[model samples]
Target: MPSKGVRVFTYIAVAGCSIELSVPKQTVVRNELNTFWNGDLEVDARNIDSLFNKKGRFSFKVLSNGRLVTEQWIDVNAITGNASGGTMDTIASTPSVFSPNNDNIIVTYGFYEAGQGHDVLPNQHQCYIAVAPNYANWQGKLAPPGSAQEGKPFNRLVLPSAHDVGMNSMQSSDSVLKKVGGAIATSLVGSHEAVAQITDSVSGPAISLVAPNIIFSLAITQKDSLDAMLQIGARYFEFRPAHCHKTILAAQALPDRLYFQHSAIPGMAYDQFLSDAVAFLLAHPAEIIVVQLRWDGVPAECARPSDQEQREYLDAALKQAQGQIVAGGLDDLRSSTIAQLRRNKKRLIMLVSVDSLSTYTDAGNATLNGDSIVAAFPKVLTAANERGKAFINIQCQATAANITEAVVYSVLDAGTTTSCIMATKAICDSKTLPWCRDNVLRTCDNNVLVVMMNDFIDGATADVAVQLSKQRLEQ
Candidate 1:
């Protein structure tokens, strides 16, 4: 548990739990792509038994500037200070073979404990250890949709949208089970008495890693802040609302109201995002905004609302955002002209699901109990401009690999074909991103749009906003 201590450097990874160690020439970051950080150890082990002699469990602290980045707990009887794996090591995200000391060296990171030994990895959680690379900033922000695109019937214009817009900061209280599960596993670190607690928590994805723990979904999605997205030329906001948290028994949701979530996992508050959008739209009157609401992560009871209930609930929420959206429901909006909507100052538009059932609202501190039926799937659709309601079409359902690649380091740094930009190009070149491009130039002509976009952080998505806003479908 003791050596020259790991040197630190800049590091990045997709994770629900994150902690970094910084030293002059080396840096080590412990992050989970599909798991939570126990957040137990942040600093190196102190080689002192008293430091870890807690309730008969041996735990060590990993701190950054004296702040607890994370901790590690082990059975008190396992190590004998005599066990040592000796080899020089470098701190990086890529995997490396090194032994700090056999008795108690942190080997595997970002995984649930192996049944027989900690050295073995659990299939459910895997962390990519590599030399941390520096990523570049985005080229530039896109221009907002204006002048050249106005008079065209709303459907005649292509819309660029973001998918799963709220998957940031999962380790915070923002997510229901993520919080409880994280605390349960983290609190008992080094506590041999509570091994069962760790077992229960890491067993499921919701509590441990949101189950299914697909390779791409290991970390929260949507890297940009709300302000950053607004500044990035995103006129359309794609979100799924869910309950914030739920009770362990009966599985009932907590009353945190509606929150932006990627399925059962919560992100930000729906109202807070709405307020920010309203403020932005108010500041930019000429810009038309669309809020596409879908049901991918709603609770069981709310997922299938009877006929009028879902529609009514949405109508009520939209009505409350009076200044943000146009008056009346789809029936009233089915045929409005862009020129008319623009003139009326109807800048904010709602794009609710084709069916009601409250699409996303589960219990617990504003959960959006919905699903991630993927908004990236492609489909061919003819324009139906005169349909009246000013709305959009989102083609959800994407392959797990495609979605996974979008959230990795490839999204920001240049890498192989698996990077985000490459995945985006594959989709953009497909029938998806350009579904309406063939005819977006014609205003009021035939106004049906199957608008969809890829997941977040950087790459083609940002350009997508710029590309559509400029009416240049040159993918």
Candidate 2:
């Protein structure tokens, strides 16, 4: 974060939702800067008490390898030829003596005219910040009785410290001026109270910091550099961000409060997850589980299943269980998905997740390839309606697929050479299957299956399991 700068507010909200949220604005400041390195420097002074009225100026310059040379000063009122003669007791001029150790410039006071009592501030006010590395010198008359045009002074290398406290200050007041800049600003009387504003910009000299490519080298020595391993896609009958204990307690205590995790796509659509969620609800009979999808805040990418598919799932669930459906998050589904889910019953409650949906600002053009994804919503609803099944849209848009945590995929392993070839074919065929298109799959050995499989049969090969599931489904 910059040590000194202005902060602005930006509102980031759920895409397409009317809700507005405020986020902090921050800018990184460079540690190495050139503004103070060079001998050339310009200063603008202003009076705060009187509508921020008053003008003063000063200049300085430094040489390469830390050398100082040529300094100048100017009074503003003198240029106007006012009887005041730009005379201000507070004004002090220090010149001569090169190579000063001082790299910083601080102006505490401004010029004040006699009889004015520092009370009546001049109408003109100005402050500036400019940088030129040994390129140019200060401008304007050093002693007055001259024009504003002053040629560049001694310069060989190095630049002055870019930090312009005065510039930053004025910029500060300018921001406030903006909010009230128009008629309201005009209505408010400007105050003149010796307010000095400065805008400081600092940057460090270029130096080598740890580079990304050097991570492995650092890891060998830095014990703390190692990253922790996180298990992904573990089923959570009850789940929480940090722990599942609380959710587990709810499940145990309330039996009726069931929780299910469905694959979720953040920022876009969650119909797939939602479909499974609704199916789970229908199958659980009297259970209302909180259906959640680990949606990465991205857009949806799936073809709408045909009515026949929806009928099969919904009809199966209705025959076995009785429950309501809830849906939210536009990625979970836009507002329309709620209406679709509600068509089946009054029990269905549509709940939107705070972050499940986002607009263009998120994934940009990638969020919605065309209105095609958007167009699929109605088709899904139509399918649900035909089956006499209720739907629920849970609005929780999560964008987490960037990591391996979104899904826990087990590697299919084969036993005999014959089984290996069959497993390879089945896995290969699954890749082209619509349901597996976005999923990751790989073949492994029996050793891997021993560690990963929860329901391990002593002699079943990976191919056998696929075959078994297929046969069972057919039955």
Off by over 4 Å in 1: 1-149, 171-179, 182-219, 248-255, 301-334, 355-398, 401-446, 457-459, 465-475
Best by lDDT: 1
> Worst 10-residue stretch by lDDT in candidate 1?
361-370
Report the C-alpha lDDT of model 1 over 298-356, residue by residue, as the tens digit: 55533333446445555554565564565333432445555567667566666577531
Model 2 Cα lDDT, one tens digit per residue, 182-257: 2211111112011000001111111011111011110111000000000011111111111112322233321221
* Angstrom error at residue 456, model 1: 0.3
TM-score of predicted structure 2 = 0.16
TM per model?
0.46, 0.16
